[model samples]
Target: MAVPGHKLDRMFNPEVVAVVGDKGPGYMWLRNNLPFKEKGGRLYSVQLDEKEIPGIEALGIQNFKSMADIPEPIDYALVAVPRQVSPYVLKDLIANKANGAGFFTSGFAETGEELGVKLQTQLTEMAREASFNLVGPNCMGLYLPKVGVRFNADAPVADDGKIGFLSQSGTHGIMFSLVSAANGMHVSRCASFGNAVVLDVSDYLEYLMLDDETEVIGMYVEGVKNGRRFFETLREACKRKPVIVWKGGQTEAGARATMSHTGSLAAPQAVWDGMMRQCGAITTNNLDETIDVMKLLLNAKRPTGTGMALLAQTGGQSVSITDAFSKAGLRVPRFSDGTYTELGEFFNIVGGSFQNPLDMAGTIQGSMDTLDRILRILDADPNVDAMAMELSAMFAARQWKGKPETLDKTIEEIALHKERSKKPFLVILHPAHEAEYVASIQPKFHAANIPLFQSFERAAAAFARVLGGGGRARTRTGVVGLALETQPR
Candidate 1:
C-alpha cells in the first residue's frame, strides 16, 4: 500500500490493520468483537511467544516478528504489548517504515520519572525520523464507525458520521463515545492520544480538519504539547469546523506540572483568557460539554449570533432556558407585537406575557402546524438569531400519541420550516426513559444541524463556547459522512 505522509489517518481510518499482541483471551475477544476487525478489514495477528492461538493460523498469522516479515505494509498498528516491551516493538515498526502506530500500553511518561521521560522523548524522535505519525503512547487508540476501527474493547454503537472526536486521554475518549451514542450523536472518528508522544492532539486534529469523515471536531486536553502549533490548528479548525475543547487539570497542581504533560506553558489567567479570545477555539471546563458541543454543532446550524426566541410547552422550562441563555451573554432579542400575536394563546398572545420569552403563545396545547409556523416565524424574523425550543412529552400528548409518524412528521415540518429560513434552532426535551426518544429523533433532526441536547447545562456550556466569539469555530469538509441526510420525507 502507498504510504501517505500522514499516518495517524490510517490509525483513525484504516482499511487494513495489524494488531501486534499476544492472542490471549482478552486480545482474541478484542479481535472478534472489536469494530475494526469485524468490518472485514484486512487484519493480521503478529503473535510472538505463544505462537499457536486457536484460529490464528487460518487468518494468515505468521511467525513473522515484525512489519518487515508481513510482506504487506499495514496502514495501522495497535501496540498492546507490555510497557517495557512496547518501545522495542515500536522500533521494529520504525525500521520497517510503518505508516502509523497506536500505543495501548500504559506506564510511560505519566509515571513522571526521568527514565520514563527519556523513553517518551526517544520514541518521539524516532517517530519524526521514521515519518510514522503516532496517536497514543498510552491511549486506547481510536474508534471509527465506517471502518469498524474501535479500541474501546466494548459494544458497537449506531454509526452516524457527525462528530469527529479527539482526546488526550483514552478513558475520556471511551466516555465520549458511549455518551455520544447515548445522546443520539454518532461517531465518525474517535481518537485518544494518551500521552501523545509523537503526534499529540494537534497532529490528529490537523488530519481531521482535512478528513471527509468528520464534521465537528472535539478535543480533551490535559495540556497542549505545543501551544503555538495547537493555537494555529485551533484557529484553522474553528474557522471550518466547530472545535470544542475541555481543558483538564485546571487547579494549581496541574498548573505546576503543565510543562511535563505536553511541554505546556502555564499562562496567567489574563493571558490564557486573551489567548483563547484570539483563537476561534471554544474551550470548556465542563466534561459534559466537552462532548456536548461537538454534538450540538453536528446537529444545529450556527446561529446568526446568540439572539434567540424561546418556545416551550411549559413556562418553567422556558424560563430556565431563558435565564441560562441570558447569563451566558445571549439575548432573547425582543419580539415584535405581530410575532407575539401569531402564537395566540400559546404565548397568551393577548396578555402581558407578550415578552421575549413570549410566556404564552397563550395556548395550553400547541398544534403541530401552529408550533411549526410559530418557530419558523421567529426564526425568520430578523429579531431573533436562534430559537430556544423547550419540548415536553406533554406537548406531544394529545396530538402526537399512538401515531409515531405524527411525531416524525411534526419534527420534519419544524425542521423544514427552519431550513428555508436558514436559522439555527435548539431542542430541549424532558428526560425520562429517553434513550429511545433521543434515538428516534436523531435521524430526523440530523440534516438540519439541530443537536437534541442531553441536558440543558450541556447545551448552554457548548453554546457559550461557540458563540463567545473569542474563539473561531472550525469546520472539516474532509470528514466522510458529515451530512447525514436521509431524504424523501
Candidate 2:
C-alpha cells in the first residue's frame, strides 16, 4: 500500500522524532538527531538497555524504556536494532502508529542468505499489512534541512536551499549533499533509501516534484522494483522539475555489484538509455558531473544559443579554452565586424589578441575601467550568446602584488556586468595550488551568482549540457516546461 502524502510530509518535516537503539560507543544516530533538537524540535531516545540510558540522558535527551512510554506521538523513528530485534521494534512502532519509520538494520534481502531473505519478507509483509510508511530496511533515510534533519552531523542545513536529491546508497547521498553545498548549491531535502523494500524512489520523486521548496531534483539510483511506475513518475516529474539521474550498474560487473548492494534488478544499459531519452530526463555518469550539471541548472541563466565567447589571461590558455568549449558541442565563434572596430580602439595588440577567445594578457595590466570596457564590448556582440573567462590566480597575484583592493574591484565590475548583461556569464578559476588566491575571490563570485568552475573542460561540459536542453523541456507549442517557469533564476 502506498503511504499517504500527509504522512510522508510529517516524516520529512517531523515535529517529534525518536532515535531507537542508540548506544554509548559512538551514539551515531543520537548525534544525528541533535540538529533537530537544536532547531527546537522535540527528541526522544528509546533505549531499553540500562547501560545506554545514562549515555542518552547525558546528551540532554529524554530517555524512554519503550515507544509506549513516550507521552506524545512520534512523527518519525530511526531504528538501529539487531535483525532479530527489528521485528519486535516494528511491532512497537506499528502499535504506536508512528507516521514513518526507517530501519538502519542490514542483513536483510541484500545478504542473499535464507535467513536474511526470510527476515526481509517478514518485515515487508508486516508493514504492508498495517499500511505502515517504512523508508528502508537498510538505509540512512532522510535529510530535510528545513526540519533540521540530517544523516551526517556536519551536513549543512538552511531554509532557503532549492535542490532536492534522492539516492539508493547512503554514502552517495551524504557525499552529494556535502559536495553540492560546498559549491553554493544547498539541498532542500535529500533521501538515502537503501534496500527500498517499502517506499521506493518513485514515491519520493512524486513528492519532490510537487514540493515548493525544491526547484531541481537529482537522483542516484541502483535499480527499481517497478520499472513502469518509476519511468512514468520520472516522465511526469521532468515536466514539472528538472530531474538529473545518475544510474549505477550500467556494465555487467556493475550490474552484479548492484544486486548485492541493494538487492535490485539492474536494468539493461540500452533500455535505460532509451527510456531516459524518451522521458526527456538528463543523465550523468559520476558524482562530479552530476554536481556540475546541477550547479549550472540551478545557477546559470539559460543561454539563448550554444554560441560562447571565451576569455583567458594567456595565449596558451586561450587556445585550450577554445578547444575545450568547441569539443563540448558549444561554438566559440568570431566576433562581429562592429565588435572588432570597438575593441581596436583601446585593446592593445602587442601582448593581447582581441579575437573570439580574447587573450587579455595586456588588458589586465591596464585599469579596471579598461577591463570593464572589453567585457562590455563582448557582452554587446551579437555573435556571443554566452561568455566564459579564465581567471589565473598566479597572474593576478603577480600583477596586483600588494593592490588586493584592485582585484576585488575588478571582480565586482565583472559581476555587475553579468547582472545587467543579456548573456550568461561563467568563470573558470584554475590551479588549486594557489589556494589562498582562489579562496579569497571564490565567495565574491558566488555571492554575485556567477557559475565558477575549477577547469575549462568542466565548465564547457556543464555549459553544453545546459544549452542542449538538459535541464528544461519544451512543449509542442514551443513553451517552456513548468519546471523552468517555477524555477527561481
Candidate 1: where are CA atoms >4 Å away? 1-13, 32-35, 55-68, 155-160, 254-270, 341-354, 361-366, 394-406, 432-449, 454-457, 470-489
**Candidate 1 steric clashes:** 41
Minimum summed lDDT over a 10-residue window in model 1 is located at 480-489
> What lDDT does model 2 reach?
0.83
TM per candidate comes to 0.82, 0.93
Q: Per-residue lDDT of 196-273 in model 2, one digit per residue for the tens?
A: 888889888988888888999999998887776787788888888788899999899999998789888777777787
- Highest lDDT against the true fold, candidate: 2
What TM-score does candidate 1 get on C-alpha atoms? Answer: 0.82
Please state every model's RMSD to the true fold in angstroms. Answer: 7.7, 5.2
